[model samples]
Target: MASEPQYRALFLGAGPQMQCGVGQFTRLLGEWIEKAEPGSCTTLTLTRSEGSFTEIWGAVGSARSVVCNFPIVAWKRVMFTPLLAMAMARLRRRKTVLIQHEWAGLHWLRRITYIPALLLANTIVMFSPLVRRELAEDSLVGWTAKKCVLAPLPPNIEAPAGMAASDLRRRLVAARQDGRLVIGHFGSIYPAKQPNALLEIGAILKQRGLRPLIVYVGSFIRGTDNVEEEFHARATELGIADDVIVSGFVASDHEVFGLFGAVDGFCYPLDEGLTARRSSVLACVQAGRPLIVTGPALPDEFDHHARFKELIDRGAIVLVPRGSSADAYADGIVAALKRPPVQAAFDFDGWWQDVANAVRAQL
Candidate 1:
């Protein structure tokens, strides 16, 4: 047999060397494709320029198609490595796909660098109308608009098998038994994520004569502004520092979901409101606990994510207005905990299949 191309596609990714969610997404997607089609895709994890070119180009050369998810937030050294490989693939006449995970939220200078990748990709996939709208606002990538198509962002984390929610719940039972509410916030802690909202809400909960324990299942992003320092400083100011817990980076999905299981309910008052791009929220909803999230700025936010929409329709998730006061958020938090626990029927596997099929169609 001729060894023309061992894999159906070459998936370029920035590995989990930093605080990037795309890294997790890239790995999960590669695993799913392999399961779905047997010998379908090869995932090449890139870290900066060290041995990236030869390996990425070799993978690109071996496969029938190329797919890359761009904008590895926080790690700029290897940011454009995938695009360079895509250019090489195009030179060899291979069709290239770009998964645009972010844009509007990035700095203007960073958005400028996306121009080359936008032009190099044969097909550009966006996860939401909001992202498409953001991309369209910039005339730099205007020509690639026709090549753009919308896709769904499935949860980055799946509930680990055999991880009993009952066992996990026992860990937090002592605090709850003492009349304390555990309010969980998932994903990288940063100002954009409004982690301070957790502290604020916890303070408000205290003000209303209730005990609140704020738990961050993820860690703070150490960036240019000393994010971790500020988070603790603000917590100190609010006088809830002792009540807060930061789990740092938990590597195990079982542990992550276990923490999810331990919480009374989850809350995220995102600065940008709810949208299709918050993979953490997607993961948290699968815990089957009540979730209080801010309403999306756009009405058609969930158009591409029908599964999420269905969950919202079924009352498994609650959405308060974007600028609701801390008192209001506190009220929603208390109310969400009181709501009967209804396991969400969020067809996670089905969502992944839809996303995979949509993307493979372009390939």
Candidate 2:
């Protein structure tokens, strides 16, 4: 498995069939690198059939360095590919960098599964201090910190220059005009994100005689868990099934942001609370609407981020106490409605350039 190095970096990623924020980030970053210098970066988005060790070995051998992002959609079986690729890279004395978005955010099993890969990586990149704080609890934290670098993730999806009114956006805006609260949740719906918790908040909104329309501008991530089924079942049990809208995998940024424009605000009640790595929340924040999210677990959570620092300061991002009940969350949603829209702008393109540069420096 040998070839003349033709690329500056070879990015190992998942295919489009699995839609997740990390997947988008991986694609965007690779594209950005390729655009900056044509033929310098190549992305290997492996389908199920494409995960053979030979394919990974060839891809890694063709590049000066290998870069892999973790926990992609449907990564259950496919996760082994990148793990094996990085390990193989080490055995061959090749450079391999592991860009870990979050540690404790994932299930314990996933954290344990990634240990070997992390150990093999010549560089360990983290998006936020939250990951660092949590990794500190583990014995490997000391080892990982030695090779770690911090790089902030740009918004995975940014609003277009203009919000062209779409049919759905018009309808949602109409409902808002009629005194209904249009709540939105973006990105793939998974259990750790607690998307169904929004349904609980919506149900509470319903009982109080407030007509709430819960809009999910994303698809469900099908996995071993019954998260998708349970989400639907809960909406049905709470008598809000009809009120729930699931926009399965909207590919257009304009369309997605148009939906964001329609909602009075966005709700992301993540069980892990707000962290720098939540690019989904960052994308929603760019819509200028209030974001009702679980508050940070630590006081200086966003200290590393200047953009979020401004957003939180302007009251654009409302923080609810962690471990709050559904009733409390419902109240937070109502209170967020009264805040003025955020006029501050986020420089997504600049952020991308920064992230790309940081990654290249390590590679």
Give the top-scoring candidate (TM-score): 1
Q: What is the lDDT of candidate 2?
A: 0.81
Q: Count the backbone clashes (under 3 Å) in each candidate.
A: 0, 0
Model 2 TM-score is: 0.86
lDDT of 1 by residue, 100-147 (tens): 876777656767878888999899998877777878777667667678
Could you give candidate 2's per-residue lDDT for residues 167-208 as a string of tens digits?
A: 778889899999998999988887889887899999999999
User: Scored by CA lDDT, what does every candidate get?
Assistant: 0.79, 0.81
Q: Any residue pairs clashing in model 2, and if so which?
A: none
In terms of lDDT, model 1 sits at: 0.79
Please identify model 1 stretches exceeding 4 Å from their true place: 1-7, 14-20, 45-56, 71-74, 108-113, 142-145, 164-171
TM-score of each: 0.88, 0.86
